[model samples]
Target: MDNLTYGIIGCGMMGQEHLRNIALIKGARVAAIYEPDAGMRAASANACAALGLGEPRKAGSITELLSVSAVNVLLIASPNYLHLEQLEEIARIRPLPILVEKPLFTDPADAPRLAALRAAYPAPIWVAMEYRYMPPVTRLIEEAEAATGGVKMLTIREHRFPFLEKVGDWNRFNRNSGGTLVEKCCHFFDLMRHILQSDPVRVMASGGQANNHLDEAYGGEVPDIWDNAYVIIDFASGARAMLELCMFAEGARYQEEISAVGPKGKIECLVPGPGRFWPAHLGEPPVPQVIVSPRDPKGPVMVEIPVDPQLLAAGDHNGSTYYQHARFAKAAMGAAPIEVALSDGWWACVMGMAAQQSAATGQAVRIADLPCAAGLL
Candidate 1:
């Protein structure tokens, strides 16, 4: 069809990022935005004008945005706590293609409700898990899948700056973000599941809020979000994954690193970020590379990292966001399939919740025991 118009909810950091990337997407334009904060609405409108995408209509509320008949899709980038509610509202209004940011719901308790809602509404909902689109990470998935014995072990590490300041500083609180794992590590969890091709069966984790946003109070409310966390997950297929996340590591060069080992060989990747927007690359940017040695030992054959030179210069998490928006536009127009499905998003959130539970109680949480495990398996 013609260019699809998307109405955005939130208009914060991620929303603005989508707006910028949508400019690069030929078949999509942000037609309306519903941000409660007037300043954010103005800023988003200014961005639209600056990008030459035309001024988007300012929507006062979700209801108003839904009322806009011109908008063909809804892009929900709101705070974590508002995800399910907004989704339910959108489903109630009409069946529109939706692109919701990762960690679909803040709390695991909402999982059953979400499932029930989906059964009733059955709208085409796609989750935004951009890590799957990253060039190096995508290569890792390819090598792992092609390996002789499959990926046996996976490791993800993120040492980067503290939580970015969000609108109203909502991200600083666990009550709003659903803990550090759900807020931040969902991307990694999603990636692990995608590469391993298995649903997580159990999880154990440990983390604490020490040196980050909690040091000070915002309007008398202390931030409860943890600054560091380590999570171990056992998948149903016997593949295992471990995550090490530290938000307090200042000046660390590679903000994120990932390694995977299979029965045949291994793959490693480092992502230079948290400062990527400046130079788009700091020093020598880590490229996605792989070394594969079969059981007979081909003597460690190295695989070249796949990168689009155009995307490498476009910034935004190695242009994953740009590709994601382009894919979203195509999917909305029925020209392509949704790469990140709703079930994938749900499982990632469920795993994050399981990790949060295990960390809190110092006990291993079985994925089967979680409330959200009903229909997902």
Candidate 2:
């Protein structure tokens, strides 16, 4: 397909963002959009109008959207719970290029289904793990070889808005969305895995509904998902990772840190976003803090790396993820290599699932038994 036709499911904030970005990607065009909400659908259509991408249609329900004649690429951005239904249908449409939003499946048990879908579809099915393609994160990973001797440990802290209150979607349900740990923290989990260059052998987690509930004043059932969680992961490479996730904070810090204790030295860098909370994902921020030190210091020698404002171009609102999808569109048109395949999304889901299992059982969930372990176990 020369000019790939794209169809988007769901018209929530994320779906609208996909539509907005479809233009930014050269080889693809938004063909149809599916949203059950009338007002939201109209809004997305209006937004697409500005780009003259044309009105998005409901495509006569999910079945037609998958089997439709005009659509080539399908972007599923619907609720966390409904992903499987659409994915299953798409699976029947074998070998079609599909771009699914993050957290491939809410449940690890669904990994088999995902495999079946991919086997059935077998085309370049991709998951939008956008952070992998972001200039800052990408550059940091690129330098991993030159910057480290051996990774000993990594840590990620995500203090985000209370998703239940902010997004108000089915993601609020643990069962529906694979809980916050997997559904939301998939990016961080994958990042941790990427940095360590290893798979988690064990995960220990503890969490409960620390916050994010409809107040008694409002009198409603709150989404029964954890607002705060601490997950500890031990990788096969002898590297351990500690992940902290809290959704109830007044200010959110998307702070990400990677520290590796290698033979030569320890490489540590902190991406300098709002350590407290900043909604600013758009503009250029100062380079994250980086420090390299000898593995065994003589006395107290120090190296303070200078600030780098040009470490990466400006980024915003997971829009860094937008470029990932852009590349997917390009790959659809045979322009660029697809970086994130379906298995990548599955690995993230498996990581999240292990965390969820660890959280529920109050034990160290082993990743050895995952169906899609790639024989790492």
Candidate 3:
């Protein structure tokens, strides 16, 4: 594995973002891409050219992309519903090192299928949870315990723009995206588990499509994707976590504000949304920040966590995609261990599903009772 040649499936907006970040790596290049949409294919080609990387061979299908001899690794950035079947196809055709996007599977019924894939897949499969690598969030995770003296409560609040239009607008429907909790809020759930260092025992949530996409109808059907939610989770370690998400509040200065508190004090991180969306009049977007307040001091100390300009230009995730790709590349080459494994991805997805279920039924959902929790527990 002298160099990594990527075979990319679905070169849409997210896939193109991956390409930009991959260009930043020394030994990684996309060898081939499988994008069904002609417009997206053209856009991806233009993106590669703009990045000064040689144009990747356009692949008509996933099989064609996988068959490319130079393609030693894989990436799946397709729609949520297609993820499981695509992974199954990859496993059957060629089990190459893969980095798949989050919310591993959309349907709860597919959990058994995912479990089977997890059991038999013969290569490293890194789930893309880029939020974990965000500079501010990473800082919070690293210093939470020391700052808070063992975190007893954690809160993550995300107030940002609604879902961007994707190819075919597949994101507008719950059936396709596994509901707002699973599709968009999975990152927060994963963060809750990761930051607490414990699995969730139960989930309670109240969310609905209060705004955005309410009047928009595609093929005579209104969009059912939710725009806001509040989820409370009880962890196995006796810690409690809450998530507050509002997709219509894009005017806020910060997109994500996370805080953890304990008997000693509190620690919080403020992360801005994508710099591209920041109004030009506001000058540069707000720099990521971590604030620590110890009980003894009673004063808060805030530090700015700035990401590299080049990395920031590469993706909307505050340079997390680049960092995640760098680590995934190493894990693929056996130089590093997989930080976000199949189990981790499963737990994240399961938590989101449970949250949605709790919201829908107006009752708390027990994580242990979910069918997907069979082997995960």
Query: If scored against the real structure, what TM-score would every candidate get?
Result: 0.93, 0.84, 0.98
Tens digit of per-residue lDDT, candidate 1, span 1-377: 58878889988888888787778877566778999987888999999888777778898888888888888888899999999899888887776888898778887778887887767865567899988777667766776756546789999999988888889999988889988899899999999889888889999999988789757789898888999999999998888999999987857766777878777667677666633533444455555555565666556666656567566555457678777878888887788888898788888888888998999999999988877777886
Clash pairs (backbone) in predicted model 3: none
lDDT of candidate 2 over 1-377, digit per residue (tens): 87777777887877776776676666566667778877777887787777667665666577766665778888888877678678887776544677788877776656667777666665677777876665545655665555556667666766656763323456666877888788888888888777787877888998778767644222255567777899998988888988887776635233555555555666555554432244457454444455555646533233333322221212334346456766887777677777777667777888888787778888887788656554334
The superposed Cα distance between candidate 1 and the true structure at residue 127, in angstroms, equals 0.3
Candidate whose TM-score is highest: 3
| Candidate 3 lDDT, 3-64, residue by residue in tens | 78898898899999999999988877777889999999999988887876667899988888
Candidate 2 accuracy as TM-score: 0.84
Ordering by lDDT: 3, 1, 2
Candidate 3 Cα misplacement greater than 4 A, ranges: none
The true-versus-predicted C-alpha distance at residue 325 of model 2, in Å, is 2.0
Number of the candidate with higher lDDT, 1 or 2: 1
lDDT of 1 at 78: 94
Off by over 4 Å in 2: 164-168, 214-220, 250-254, 268-318, 369-377
Q: Which of the two candidates, 1 or 3, achieves a greater TM-score against the reference?
A: 3
Q: How displaced is residue 167 in candidate 3, in Å?
A: 0.2
Q: How large an RMSD does model 1 have?
A: 2.3
